[model samples]
Target chain A: MATSIRGRGGIGPALPLLTPAYLWLVVAIFLPLSAMALFSFMTELPMSGRDWSLTLEHYAAFFSSGLYVTLLWASIRLGLEVTLWCAIIGFPAAYVLARVLKGRAREAIFLLVILPFWSNGLVRIFSWAMVLREGGLLDTTLNAILPFRIDIDLMYSYPAVIIGLVHSYVPYMVLTCYLTLQAIDNALIEAARSLGASRLQTLRRVVLPLAMPGLLAGSVLIFVPVVGSFMEPRILGGRTGTFYGTVIEDQFVAVFNWPLGAALSFILLAVVLVILSLSAPILRRVQ
Target chain B: MTNLLGKLAAQAVLLSVCTVSVHAAELHVLNWKGYGADEPWAVEAFEKATGHKVVNDFFNSEQEMLTKLRTNPGLYDVVMINAAFTGQALAESLIQPIDTAKIPNYADISGEKANSPMLNQDGKVYGVPWVWGLTAIAVNDKSFETSPTSISVMWDEAHKGRVVIRDDAVEAIQFGAIASGQNINDIKDMDAVKEKLTSLMPQIRTFWSSENDWNQMVASNQIDIGTYWSGSADRAKTQFNLPVSLVIPEEGAVAWLDAFSIPVGSDNVEGAEAFINYMIDPEFYVEWVTKVGAPVSANEKAVAALPEDAFNRAVMGDPKVADRIQFQAPITDEQRKEYLAIWQELKVGAQ
Candidate 1:
């Protein structure tokens, strides 16, 4: 298949076809990243005739202060927790959709899975606040059904942040896992059953390994953004929301220290890259 | 064919001339979204009276505002700047000094506000005083038996896990400084301020960033008390129907004044000045304050024109309250960094 396509032009026709996408990547992604990298080494923004010189102080500031490193670890932990929650909640839903449900019902449930993407993210977060705050929907409903009074004030706490993030990102896990799970042959599962494997063992040894790529893909998609999210934590985490992303946000909008913000941003990018590289080996094996 | 071409040429010439005239009469304004400058009626009135159209752009924060002015020079004719940042704008030459004599309404501006050091340097007025407001303590009326008068209520153990404050480094540090009896602008004892802020952390339920956040938290009964803007507090009470009371604590409230200035390289300087004159006029101020809950107007006559029980007049009109008000001073970049560092450390420690 590769030789048939290439035999016509010997990479000549493909160059023009691929140029626009590569150009876009260079213009949209690389240029800004390169600018940010340069900016991360500056004393001040090289605008408005302000006297500025090349400096390593901004990078040094990050290392000298323990606050940034601590917050970065906190954000990483938040990313991991949210990713795990998303996997737990989404995998089963995907399984039911891919295996148990039939044509029209499967389509309806699939639509429901992706429904959260239709609305604005901010609106969804605020809706959770409505449900999570004291005297909110969750609290009112619980108290009404039960004989005794109970409080369910989860707003502005760490758990609330995690819940909001997981709610926002679970759709990615569902979509990715559903595709892979649906591709697993019924014959293979039947063969496992005929070989005297239990339902749990069949899922553990056969189904899980087959769905690894999709699970890993979904985890990566959810993990990266969750690590750098400022708005979700700010709205739901309350005082506890001061993670690495929020601190970087302050450096730009609140503190007007763009150089330092760029430095911090570059550091975050490097850390994310390292994480991705570490997972590349496992991802390659699954593929 | 010649006649048909002649008619087309004539129409094209007339269209180009009209376009040039309309473009010359347009003024680009930079301000906060929905803050008096872009009010539909006010814009209509200004355009009708001056024969110049107004176009507005918004910035969410003072830092973003500076960045816009810095990056997009000559794009904006007039800008609304907080007085605390006017000095920085002047130092960077982002905004040119206004010719107050060109603005007819400049005479009616209150002497204290017009001559404020933040807006003036070396006897030249850089920013024309427009409006002012207070960052004071606001409490859910049901939570307090009697109106709390001191800022200490934020640190009161009874309100622990029910108290909130703005998540701003400058405001938080200044609030802490005031609570610790240090000057808001010049804090000689950083250790004391840090101690006071660190102690207040446990009492904080969450930090509110935007006015919407404050209203949602307060309305839902998640927070009983917190630091809030006086103008927003008024709106929360009157518009949102929230039972919020704005308090001028014994230690005085943090005050901020917003001003209008012409940016450097503005093509329509005359139109910008006229627009600013309209903005500060008693007619505009009175209509804006009465119709939309607004910050205190810089025009004294505008304040007097309000009904006796008007929110701004009732709360900020008193001379005693005015005397105690600690208007925000220009924050140096170094000082800002230091304050932010302290604020970040405090938040991290709390977490």
Candidate 2:
């Protein structure tokens, strides 16, 4: 359809069709981002007749404070950990769904894989709280079945935060990997195995390399949001929940420092762009 | 055809009578969810009596409330603001001075609360005192051999890894200030406050930001003792049946009052005042306190009317405890940043 349209009007005819999407991007993405950038340099929000002036102090504050840098590092580490766990847990599930499962069973299991997305995020986080808290379902069930009592309290800890995030994001990894894994020709795997290659070797040499794009896509999908996540950490990590995202949230909501919040957010955006650019080479090579 | 015309005439007459009797105006109220203003029965009663429908919008934080007031001028007729923020609202002219004459129940409000400087600017009232409560310690009865009386119990080595506090910078700083015997409104030494809070790092199991979080931690037996709101403690005990006890420490507790204010560009001032009046009415207060847990009503008459066994009365009745209450004062923007900086540092240090 695009070629036919271009054959008639040399792209001018498509401008009307494309304008809406581009306009939407400019309005929804660029406009608010530009506004945030402008606010980041402001002394205060120019509203309600409050005195305001342009200033670099918010960015200066971010640079001067070691605490923000440390928290940003912590957040990055959290993102990496959560992404790694998601890949580890999700890849096997995706493999089963794509290679092992067949017919109605695959569809049903796929439905179940995406089931967490159907429920409210807060409700899901709270449900995890019930299961992870001390003397909670996990603890009582373990103690009830085991010969000896063992405590299994994991709530409000770093592990709990990781578990919650991994639970929330693992589906993205599964969905992405399943799509790519399904597209790979099974004949290649069979041929590798029919030759001298063993099953592990077939998987590592044939299947894994084929699935790299999906894995990278899944990693990017999971990593970006986890780094900025506040609710999961606040609800699950508790005392250890404070992160770069939560601090920025505090500046806006608790501290009423929007200029600083904007600055922090803009910095996070820059960091994410840098990381994405750094990873682009690897993604291109894998593809 | 004759019967249809007769029915249409009858319907028209009824509609006219209804319109004449009811002067209904929708009042948009801003408050914390589940707080007094949004009580279903009370709103129903107010609507029935005054023929004005109440629509409630909630904010999770005081800053969000201020933002709503600032951004959406003429949208909200009535807003519930903490007294500490009332001065800021007045300064920004986000809220207009409430005429006490419009709310007859204003006379029944306790003079101390009504005359609080936080609600007044240039001798004009910007907010009408509504409800008040404390940020103090709550103890799990099962974990304690005896009641703990001092705020220092938070730092007690025995309860290490089982204590929690709200995850708010200002509240945490004020808590530290109180523990260090510095006035909440005026802390001279920042380092001392930082030291006191840093010392508390070992004792904290987690930090709770909401009533639900606090209740869940206590219910699951995750926390033994922590800083909690007085009103929430009442709910945990009476409603949820959690074995929690509220303790006012010897070092005193932080108190905050929520007040009803008219936004500057309110389209329905009469309706707003009527809603505020109904909120402070003794009858409404009695039902709200009995059916649902709440901060103590600012109206002395409402407090007096509570049953002797009412949870609020049992917890807040003592005049001696009142003497030790340190009402939260207005904090400057700079002060908030400093407190948040110290708090962020402390949280980072904990990790």
Candidate with best DockQ:
2
TM-score of each: 0.95, 0.94
Of the true interface contacts, the fraction found in model 2 is 0.84
Compose the digit string of candidate 1's lDDT tens values, residues B171-199. 99999888888778888998998999999
Q: For candidate 2, lDDT tens digit of each residue in B35-110?
A: 8788789989999998887889999999889888989999999999999998888888889988899899999999
Question: Per-residue alpha-carbon lDDT of model 2 for A1-287, expressed as tens digits?
Answer: 87898689798877898899999999999999899899999998988888899999999998897999999999999999999999999999999999999999999999999999999999999899899987889998999999997888898889999999999999999999999999999899889988989989988989999999999999999999999988898888877888999889988889889899999998988998899999898789877
For model 2, which pairs clash? Answer: none
Residue-level lDDT for B141 in candidate 1: 85
Off by over 4 Å in 1: A6-10, A279-287, B1-18
Q: Give the TM-score of chain A, superposed on the true chain A, for all candidates in the order listed.
A: 0.96, 0.95
**Model 2 spans with C-alpha error above 4 angstroms:** A1-9, B1-24, B309-311
